[model samples]
Target: MIDNRDPLSRLKAALQVIDSQRKILSDSKSDEMLVRDLSAIVRYLNSMSISQASHILEKAHRRGHDQKKNQAEDFTQAYNLNLDDIQSIIDSENVTRGELESIAVGRFQVPKGSLRSIGNMEQLKMKVSTLVQNERSHQTISKLAGDHKYK
Candidate 1:
């Protein structure tokens, strides 16, 4: 039996109970038994306190952010691209033509008409940089606006 005094402990106990119940439900042969178990599990979760629900939501939010950060790091490593270079592109309002030429021809050595099977490297880089900047700006605005809860 779980001690109901401590909210966090109770939350953990509920999760463990749910996990065990799910395993049993998966192994059950009868459809009626499965339905009953599933309904019980849903009722248990629905009975959780607001504080417990918030804690669970915060944990999920942090996990999602960590996953996205890990994926971005992996992509940067796989492509042999510097994080600073990407950040610089995102921070800048507009990348000059000279900088684009330097990156495309001098740095990457991407041949003309090689990018997107038609466009030149400079054109592709410019488009990509602009898109990144716009995305960054949008994220900044959203963060400033903050999250809103509706009744």
Candidate 2:
């Protein structure tokens, strides 16, 4: 329950919880802790129940994870690259426009549609280099090996 009896204060309190909850939800591992967080964010008498929110959001997160997993699987299947080779391309800054585009639009879903940068090698290299620096690149590299699936 909101500590404040005033209507405006109560709304402000809920807003504060919602703001904090947004950050937690984004980073949460979808564990039991999420239930506690939601319970705190929304008091059952005031708004949506914790159970309903948890079920919906957890399902959405699960679907998103599955989608990313499928996309990564398909990308690695097509590329079949060893980690050393993948790293070499990233380090060389000489990766092809097609390869960069594949990773960007196909795997990372960086703004769908044909990027004008894809036609320009220098631009493509810069974009892909940025991508390589991201955690997604590291995760994708870990998926390849000497192997085809993600760990």
Candidate 3:
């Protein structure tokens, strides 16, 4: 359970509540006033200094936070992205530390603390390769065992 006493948690919860309300409206025709109101509320909250709005949005909006997905699953959004594709890009380009950090943290939702242990591109690539291999193996096993959860 989430701690109710934490201010950050409270703020996150509030944002999620607003988001759910918006989701409900999406089932019907576009309601500009209501949608704008929700967006305004988000803007107001973002303007506040109590906490970074991104921290809340990251938890609420990102696919990586889905219960079944691992946080480090980065390339699922791409139809064609793969290990060799990424490797080729890295080899052909001067990928900076900042760019790597953004992909790891911003896109993948990988926690900064977890990324600290991986000090170089080679380490990150190897870690991802291992993860993908394991995931494929697990999927194959699940399919063979008729585990519909994976399907």
lDDT of each: 0.59, 0.60, 0.60
True-structure RMSD, every candidate: 18.0, 16.5, 17.7
lDDT of 2 by residue, 1-151 (tens): 5544344445556556775765576567556666566656555424645555455556766999998897677566535654445446656755666566556665446764657636677777667557656745677677675376456
Where is model 2 more than 4 Å wrong at Cα? 1-85, 91-94, 117-119, 136-151
Instruction: Rate residue 117 of model 1 by lDDT.
Output: 52
* Candidate ordering by TM-score (highest first): 1, 3, 2
**lDDT, residue 109, candidate 2:** 62
TM-score of candidate 1 on Cα atoms, chains taken together: 0.34
Best-to-worst order by lDDT is 3, 2, 1
TM-scores vs. true structure, each candidate: 0.34, 0.30, 0.32
Give candidate 3's error at residue 111 in angstroms: 2.0
Candidate 3 C-alpha lDDT tens digits along 12-130: 67877887787678666569788878878866874655456445555665655583364334324322355455445445547655445445454345676797789888777655545
Cα lDDT tens digits for candidate 1, 1-151: 7655555566667677776776676677547677577768767776788697768767877899997786555444424544357547534658544344334433344453454452554556665565446657887788867765353
lDDT of 1 at 60: 74
Clashing pairs in 1: none
